[model samples]
Target: MSDRIDKSLTRKKLDKTLKPHWVWAIALGSSIGWASFVMPATWMGEAGPLGVILGLTLGALLMIVISISYGVLIRNYPVSGGEFAYAFLGLSRLHAYISGWFLTLGYICIVALNATAFSLMLKFIFPNFIEQVKVYEIAGWEVYLTEILLATILIGIFTVLNIRGTTISGRMQFIFVAILIVGVLTITIGMTSSAETSFSNLTPLFTPEISALAAILTIVAIAPFAYVGFDNVPQAAEEFKFSSKKALTLIVLAILFAAAIYSLMILATGVAAPWQEISQANHAWGTGFVVQEVLGTGGLIVLATALTMGIFTGLNGFLISSSRVLFAMSRGKVLPKAFSNLHSRYNTPYFALIFAAVIAIIAPWFGREVLGWVVDMSSVGVSIAFFYTTYTAYKLLKWSEQDEGYNPELHIVSPGKKVVTLLGMIASVSFLVLLLYPESPAALGMESIVALLVWIAIGAIFYMIRRKELAKYTREELAYLILGKDQFKLKKEEE
Candidate 1:
């Protein structure tokens, strides 16, 4: 593993061209996609606008705590694997592989989810274009051949875009995110000004039937999915062309920004469309209907265009992040070395991007209903990764306090931060459990649970097969593999 790292360093490196703001763009774009437009209806249906607001508020607070822990970890390590790197450093190789597996699953699911979302967005905008092409039926939902083809084409396009280079993806992310923000703001302003929309629509803001705690918990359970992309900052840490402080600041800002965007989307939907109508309509097109009502057909087109751009940004960002995670895992010897191979010209993990794209291309065939199950299951995986990362952060803080060579300047792990991480772990685990509840909004049904189990089982088999080979490397060797010898040397000098 160490030899591979040393050899690779001479061949290529992840480009260090991304500034702090570009990092923010990736995070923001990875989130705030079709999910932002679609999910609020579910939240608003279960709870009203006020309930949704409260849920998002509490979820944001929890995500802030998680982000702070991530900021500290990334500041110290500044590696591409994000949680996988942290776990390898603070815990063990086995722990790191497990974290990487779950995180990778989440990213792949997001890629697939967003591809399907893009197709759905098109369906909303042009309802008649492909309505006649029925593929199959699953769980009472009709699967369309055209939708599957569109999703596959999208996955292929995004895979190529990502394989081209991180610079191209980052540039695309910024443009799309800018359009999304402007579209959202325009919709909000227009909706507020329209006489058709009334403040009275916000009446009975909280759900009359559901308790506040339950409503908030519902949103919190799915919040991981909504906020998953902010952590992409850490996954691209090696590519950042800025100070660690700036990177950390941008990460926090991205979290806050995404939370605000999600909340505002919910507010706009509630204000622009009647709660009863939104609740009864297909949650996927609920926001579209709101836009149509508030801004007419022209505004709906603009919003769809912006969301389509958002889908591209999201797919690009996740591809960038997921490939890095695979590259790091491969470099660490947990997976095959082929995954770590960067394109000669692009300096991106081309093999890993294609691997993820293959998954995205095939996933849509299961139909959107099953994909929803996959998305929820992916959130559970993400929460598990979050819990492990937070636990590792707390463990590292304690270790730093005891190690004589530990330098406070290199790592920011205070007792207060430890407490926050501990809280984050609890929240993460609670959400994981909540996601498993049979009646929870994002609950994993039997089929989804079986699918998740099968995925983990496959990972377990691979781990068993590679366990002996992976065990050849000592912790020091593993660290060198992940951080490179120069970084390891710098850490030693700092300590």
Candidate 2:
């Protein structure tokens, strides 16, 4: 394997987004598993305050393992494709197909959920405009026209930002995430005095019921989503100068910052309203829920405005991350070359991004709790990706070149790394096993294999038969493929 070379112009411009420290900070912070706040965390905590706490603790523990191991992989085998890129290096083309398919589907689900949230916010800010959907209902249509319109607009914005390239997209992420953290803190602190929190509720004592474990696993499992957005951060690696080191640091810091922020918000919100009441009264959170809960009318307006912008930013995150995954797949010839194309001017993958937006625009009409369903599948994608990477890591440790070739800066063989990666894989596989059970699958396996398979098939057919026409995006992805090329070989280099 070759060292990562600065052979591409597109990558160089992307480096301008953030230098080393900013790269690590932005990437790490950007991936903060945010949907946990938007979806299950609030409801779970509300439904069973103790239950959610236990679950969050358990899930966070597992995620810590998963995340650290993921970081190791990123540090060792940095690349533009998130999980898919890693898999392609270690696993067979078949597993590569599997990983990319799941990630693309997972990202689509992310976009769908983000777009859905954006549309819902639009309805809140302009109820009359959304109320126009009633007119569509009268026409015997099952879909909500206004919701679709609003969603399309959000998707359009994401596609446009993504077309502008990684630097712009990543900075956009930093801006939104920054505001989102501040807004959440302001609301949580202003509303719930930290001293008011009941210490007993802070640590729930669960009975001997399995519900405790399952529920906790579900909650903790979600923290991975908070970190999942980092998947896109690496997609822009080609744009970084010292991507291997800088990108890894950025991804890790982002996770830590986000985790801290979430803990504070949960603490504040938990104090403001009892878990059960918040769960029962306000299952869905947005501008209305946050404001009404925190500051009444004033809070409502403030939260509404912040939420509107935050969710729109989330949509942008989805657009850039998901499309990048597809773009990476396209470059590998697993997908159509069109997906790999760069806008000669903006230096973004225009067609793949537009493709992502179109699907995101259409997802809301499914009216099926877009986030709820997507979260389950996204969990699957996360786990599957983790599983492959960890297994590859195990292989890396056992078989990488040894006999004096070593990376003292890297720590793949340390007991801590080993234990965590193993446990992370266990946690991921456990969630997957739980999904096989019909009763719990919906809660943890919302990602659609059918959907994934269809997308992969489409991508493959286009690549094999239709790739000749689309211009290819180029430049060497050396370090990009090295980390996952089998751990044993890395050991050999260590020698």
Which candidate comes out best when scored by TM-score? 1
Q: Give candidate 1 regions above 4 Å deviation.
A: 1-12, 398-413, 437-443, 485-495
In the predicted model 1, the residue pairs found to clash are none
As a whole number from 0 to 100, the lDDT of residue 87 in candidate 2 is 66
Residues 1-495, model 1: lDDT tens digits: 444334343323578878777789998888676788777777788878887777777777788888877877777777788889877766678888889998898898888888988878877777787565898898777888888888888889888988888777788788888888888887777777888887778767877787877767777777788788888988999888887767667867777888888877787788776786788786558888887977889888777876787788788889888899999999888889899898888888899999988987888888878877777678877887888778767766744456665655444537788788889888888888888878876566787798789888998998999999887765556777786543342231111
lDDT against the true structure, each candidate: 0.79, 0.57
Model 1 RMSD, rounded to 1 decimal: 3.6
Q: TM-scores of the models, in the given order?
A: 0.91, 0.77
Leading candidate by lDDT? 1
- Candidate 1's TM-score reads 0.91
Q: What is the lDDT of residue 381 in candidate 1?
A: 78
